[model samples]
Target: MASGISDAQLAVFVLSLRRSNPPSDTSIVLFMDSVSPRAREIMEAHAVEGVVFDKSKFGDIHPSTYRWPMITEAVEGRGAAVGNVLVADIRDMAFQGDPFEVIGREGGGLHVFTGVEHITLGKDGWNGGWVRDCFGERLLESIKDEVIICSGVSVGDRDNMVGYLKMMSSEMDLPSFKQCERNGVDQGVHNVLVHTGRLKGGGVDVKVHRQGGGTVANMQAGVAKYRRGEGVVNGEGRMVDVVHQYDRDGELQDHLFREFVEWDMAVEGVGEGGCEGYIIKENTEAYKGICDLSHDPGSDYLECCKVCNGKPNCRGFTHIRKGCWLKTCGNNGNKELKVVGATGAWKV
Candidate 1:
């Protein structure tokens, strides 16, 4: 379910799930292109099972391209087994309760949830506007007022989930989606399929879960409604089963993560490392940068470190051929050295 090195956010996500659900009732399956040493260590520490895939199958396509195919492979490889399948974004997520329990309460049908954004199509939202432009005026005019669907969190029974992912993968190759061949297309196609009832065409029952109203709470646009408590509660004051896109709000994200860290320490007697006044030395090949997680470039090493330092959970940064890559220390802030062509530094 993750593609790269394990970070602090990923640790928080898995740990939250472990804390919320007992292993006897839940199992964690991780799918990755390749597991890094740090990621492997965390997986061993948490007893998470991993499935590795050959990256060449998808080529050097967008990260969104891997989403559906991976899900399809995982579900189908299990013989289309009967169980609730939750496809979630690992980074920037934390669990307050058992997700399967919430889904069970929803009567055990197909459900897709979206993170709410403040801006809408043809307005100030750049991504939404691009989607509108790609589909043209006529198509957008029909659903101009519809809420944007987020592809981050999706859940359904095994058969339905596999069917949904297969549909999405097929739709991505269509001529109509040619112009939409960029990032966020997965979400665009998801919205189109659900809003237009394409899933129904395949005899799949689907329901749209909106932010602040569903078992899963998307904080992308509803950060104000998130208060620091035992768990995140929606506007109606009900505890949400799953929370997504919290990293969009730095203050709230930091608070929630710190809360989890405190809880982990108090309950499990575990301690975490801190990064303060640390700098990654230049020409260090071990911590070579793999990829840039930033949306933009042009940040120098000092600037990148400062940005990472200012962030609540950021522990280190990798400056490489591409750009700056920020990292979290997870349980241990100590930077793991591996041969690469980038420099890594840490700060608290």
Candidate 2:
């Protein structure tokens, strides 16, 4: 759930949450940015009954939405409020474990917690290379799952949420900079204020969970990157989560799927969490080489940009491990908007 959750997947996610038997903390507020009418419809359908619709004051928009300067715009507010809250992805589908059981109250301020994707297996270690390059090896331990902590599943208390948002929004110059759930992204953003040495003196342990997604569905065959230490692929020789494009009624659209199927076949089937194109963030590296990269050097990847540096993709990546998967745009190459599957089938 850290990196993906599509409109189709989100529908199932909301329905599933509503269907969970034991029921979870009523305080959990599902927050997301809406773009098109279709996306909003999906949200309204999945929303809990009786909960009044309140636009996220921060006004978060999807990465595709042109209003933002940052890839993820929702982590701007978190430390002002004091109520318990959970922020999960739309595809985080099932809620097997009771969140209240996992989230307990701590010292003076609340301590939000979340599971960080393992550097090689879970989180995108390579993209975080800039942090390492900027901060060095010691940062590897202290700031280990920094990005994923900000991007993945999270739990927060109001005070910490708002206070943290104030710091990030102001310090980072986030837009509008309002205090709302939209600012509640994963990264233990309040780490410095809440989890620092002062809290440790009180024996507070605000740390990353290190494991995401529970056992059942997570154990499915096609989900793992490798089976018995070997590469994984479906019976059709296509990778897991193939982007098959189709019409509204679910008809195959081979032309759209061609690019990805071509890219997949070309790359010997991209690794785990493969994508037909970037979500403006390119190549679901989670499926491919997205290993415990943050933990080990091998878990890393590099970006190669040249245009901005006056070269194009070759301009110079500046050593950051972020870039969208290249697209064939007018022979020059650009990131695409949507990923149409190889055979024009339903993506969901």
Candidate 3:
């Protein structure tokens, strides 16, 4: 299934990035292997470069049937000379500052730096210092393996990323992967590769940043001595570009994101063609379809949306009978009604 984030959040992110990062010859690229029906329409309407599985490349089957392998394929022959391949899984990002400037090119090496709660790290609860102060080492170790990574947003040179990408395509579990609903398995392989010293060939670095101390840091900020390593995940050397509040729910996250979007809008207005400028039609024939799928034979609105399979920039969707509503997301529901309401003269 596609991620549960709404299209509005995505629109805000793209818009924010356009203004924050501005642009250069560096063509910011956003890639997705499989795009849902209406979601594709929405993103395309916005003018974002959206890629779906090329049938010539995919054939008639669930694209996810070959997820890891295919995603690894998409990364191929792409990131070589791009300004900076700042890749973000659809659900794995929040654009705080200009990611273009913040996320360095892979030339420096493979690195993932995101702010996760300091309470969680490795197998043990907290290292000797932070959590130890709270519960001591013995108690912390008791809950080892119970932790989850918040978001280790990595950055790197990505020169030979194709190499590892290819390897993963071959090594990633296939049909048998149904039984492997484990952690981010692909990233697990990546972690193993980096820690074991496998990605140093064409020069890519992998680094992570976990939340431990009080404040976030930028390159010039006071990070730890070891975190400054060329490829250290959970490093403290720099202020994070985005903080993933993964703990929150969908609606609440939207509320929080509004502050961010409004801040950006205030700072620099809507970006010229930054977001995939989309508008939804209200009272169109589409709503009847939404009412059908929404309360339909299978009330799993989310699952139906999942069956649709959305990708990056392919923001939120509403499944219906005859057709689906692709764009029109801002807050709780479709934005057309709210937009009309604000107009006052258009109300029924």
| Top-scoring candidate (TM-score) | 1
TM-scores for all candidates: the values are 0.71, 0.39, 0.48
Q: Is candidate 2 or candidate 3 better by TM-score?
A: 3
Error of 1 at 40 (Å): 1.5
lDDT of 1 by residue, 1-348 (tens): 576533555577778888876566666787777777666776787778888877677665566656676667667877834477888878667787888775677765578775665555435364455457556667666655677777788888777787888888787767666655666667766766777677899877887776666778888767326665555777678888888876655445656556544222111111123334664554332222332334224245656655665677665666656566676552243433321234556552
lDDT of each: 0.64, 0.31, 0.38
Ten contiguous residues with the weakest lDDT in model 3:
339-348
Model 3 TM-score (2 dp): 0.48
Pairs that collide, model 1: 1-31, 275-347, 275-348, 276-348, 280-345, 286-338, 288-342
lDDT of 2: 0.31
On residues 138-222, what C-alpha lDDT tens digit does candidate 3 reach at each position? 6435433332332224443455445555554554454553343233444444443443445554244554443443122221122
Task: List ranges where model 2 is wrong by over 4 Å.
Answer: 1-5, 21-42, 45-82, 91-94, 104-127, 133-150, 163-171, 174-207, 212-348
Candidate 1 achieves a global lDDT of: 0.64
Runs of candidate 1 with Cα error greater than 4 angstroms are: 54-57, 117-124, 127-136, 175-179, 259-298, 301-348
Sorted on lDDT, best first, the list reads 1, 3, 2
